[model samples]
Target: MSLRPNPPCLNPQTPPPPQSELDNIRRYDVKAIANYYRRRPWKVLGRALEVLWSFGFFLTCLLWDQWTHQVEYYKRQRAEDLRELLTKLGPTFIKVGQALSTRPDLVRRDFLEELIKLQDQLPPFDNDLAFQLMEEQLGMKVDEAYREISAHPVAAASLGQVYRAMLFSGEEVAVKVQRPNLRPRLSLDLYLMRLGAEKFGRFLPLNLGHDLTLIVDEFGIKLFEEIDYLNEGRNAEKFAENFHGDAEVKVPCIYWQYSNQKVLTLEWIQGFKLTDIDKIRAAGLDPSNIIKIGVTSGLRQLLEHGFFHADPHPGNLFATLDGRMAYIDFGMMDQLEPGTKETIASSIVQLINKDYLALTEDFIALGFLAPNTDITPIIPALENVFGSAIGQSVQDFNFKTITDDFSELMYDYPFRVPAKFALIIRSLVTQEGLALSLDPNFKIVEVAYPYVARRLLTGESPQLRRQLIDVLFKNGKFQWQRLENMLSIARSDTKFDLLPTAQLGLQFLFSEEGLYLRRQILLALTEDDRLHTDEVQRIWGLVKDDFRPQELVNVAWNAVREFSLAGVSTILPQR
Candidate 1:
């Protein structure tokens, strides 16, 4: 049978609608359609040619590898060629390359390294054009806005250029002026890239575990957000708020009056780059301490506040003479939802405890796997990766090694790294590499453990609190081993006290809330309808010794007896 649908039937006496009526009912403009066909052909042809050239270059590289049987050499050469092509393509592709540098899952290590070298250091546009744009954007002449402005840009980036200028009030400021005619060009480029992605997906049998179109859309959104200097100004303010009163961490202040969508004025920071170890040492700053400040601040941003600076490359961070770690260029930042933060926190706890089962559950909870995915295989995978480092000192732990191992597993599993998670990983890995460059012995995990441990012990989240309760009171008895591990981690920081935690636990166990909790525990122990009498006796034994007043023990015992009288059978196993 033919699958084609029947055409619409026409009655012999019925006439079709009038031509004028049909034209009026039309949903599209014929003139616009004709204009699109007329104007778009050349542009489409040009883009197609460019894509064909890129494909040919890569295909040639692959053919060369096949002919010579030199896989690694050709791979490196291909990466270099791709980097050069991306650079020649201008700002949009450069930004895409930068984003790709962060995705180790998408690219090999060598290619990623080469892509990271794709600096957005385009030549500055005409100084007169910049001045004109500043005037147009800020509604004032450049001379009136600044007492002195640099004739040449101090730094020229892909999207904008920064000039060191002094305000009329004698305050030093960095004036960032967006490139002339950038928005239209960027918009067109992004649209073309989206079209290319769609076409590529249609033609290539690719399984990247994510939609290429969606990735391009996300990258475009991020790039557009960076294009708006006002959005960047707000991001700086938000980060400053997160680190308010922190003397060690500094965020450049934005001058709102002098700032607009196309231009930004920020406090000019006079400091050496964090990677400038010699200058930092000459300025009487300890590089190790500076690294600590950076790591600790980053941890607080990631774990405590759930907001983080996504890009902390050396150029974007500086160490001041006063030993403050100053962060600049707030164009790219990431935020973690509260639930993601909790999952990360729990994962840290599980990692510290070496609880592979719990870690597997964390992986599932974090959406790293499908809901019905069997995590048994993942548990062993994690153990294989982290087993040797389980009981090692924090100073001996290497986050990079663990990350690499996990990346290897990710290649084999059906795991998908969410964009935010990938950004977090990229930020940390970059920060760690920078820190190690300054101080070879730097261990980020060592500096981060105290904070993670303290949060698990003191966090007010009900989920965390329940986990802590389960850890301390397992099988209806206090687990001294778990308590010792918690204490050991907390004790490393002299400022963290265990007294408050102990008092809180004691208070919870003595109040009416405690009696209700005890009753619930008894009910849970008997919920299976076949309660082990010894388990009940053991719980009663602990209650008798631990309860402050005798009446509390009696109440707990009576609850157990009530459950026993119900359908729950009390079976005592033979000793």
Candidate 2:
């Protein structure tokens, strides 16, 4: 983790951007600033202020060198400052900056730490402006735009603010207002990021071989899509439609005519967030049931359907009075290539089977690790960690102990990954933290097993089965040979090191051997099915399948629907 103080290539000047890359500046709408600020002079003043503030902060950091402090004072101050500023900047800058902050490699640690502090405390936008934006977007005033609109904002986010409102058709709705002049300000920030990267490459570890210009120009285009309210409004509409029929969850209906590039109006939902324990209790709902609802919705969004909300924070979620979970914002959505989802399912299975090589390969495919990096040391490193995890299977494993060891190993020899991939890791880590907060004894693997098993049954087709068979055959043979070798070693006069080999062997056998443990799955489809099969596969192994445990519940629901209509025993008569 320590950098050589001044490595030869480290301080070299970045190569100049190609002319074609330079043309990307055109994608930025210079005039959008005028529209948002409502005057050319204010746009100029805003840019000047941004420049002055940035330079002043940089100069202060460099000159005085507040080198020592009681408790990381500078880092804390920076974070607090970022939180305040994002709140002050309305919405667009907050959103754009957050996406940047998630890239630890893109910004320095002090700033990233500070930006993360903005997570919950950014100030809400003016409700009056929210109404004005609604009028502007729909080409009518608030009274005309909706049947009823809640005066209060239910949630405020980096990109926009959400308020509960109702349309003329008697539909309750949530209206999101994009801060005025956000489009132009974010474009400037994108340019500023390029400048910072080129000028300060040594301070950051960007993608090694790519030109700074190309890297940032691509970043600009993506950020461009993010600030566009129109696109975000569309994203919301599409997701609302995707989950429209689901009863356990709802994506608010979008009011497109009342939505524009600067505003959005959708169905309003009154419910408590998943993390709002007191409110959840007040609603007379079980926290466990709410957890299940959130988990199941996330599974459906990510698995059966590839499109999903990139951020699933508590603020973006709500639990209804009757117990259904509500999803609101959709400004940032992530769509996985179909294969990536498959790789994840198989990767978990690989982890269960302890196939470190396939696990490493899957990491590469999933963008969890650097491509072309030496993975040999890593394979052993993982074996040491994953082995400890599987000695009792994922269900029985103590993740704190296992992860501490894994974290130690990773800290010792870390690998680089893309920012997008890192964000996914961040989400899982955050979710795990939330789960532990709810109950320290909670095991994500245990909770997630049902969802994984369901996906194994449904997400995978016969092609997946063929691949599963091929992979399992190799892994099983490998395990047999490994068991034989260990046995052979055990007979030797000298006791060999089974610790490492045993660990390595365990990972391989689980992922490979459990590939098609269908009978074990049927057993775990519910608590009552325990004796349906004499043999058992570890629940974690079942979780590793392309299937999700939630899918099992879905199957049950469909069966119930069938029974309500037909009165049948597709409902599993007995154990």
| Candidate with the greatest TM-score versus the true structure | 1
lDDT per model vs. reference: 0.71, 0.57
Per-model root-mean-square deviation over C-alphas: 14.0, 14.8
TM-score for each predicted model, relative to the true structure? 0.76, 0.66
- Kindly give the number of clashing pairs for every candidate: 0, 28
| Model 1 Cα lDDT, one tens digit per residue, 349-380 | 77867778877778888877777888878888
lDDT of 1: 0.71
Which stretch of 10 consecutive residues in model 2 shows the poorest summed lDDT?
1-10
Total clashes for model 1: 0
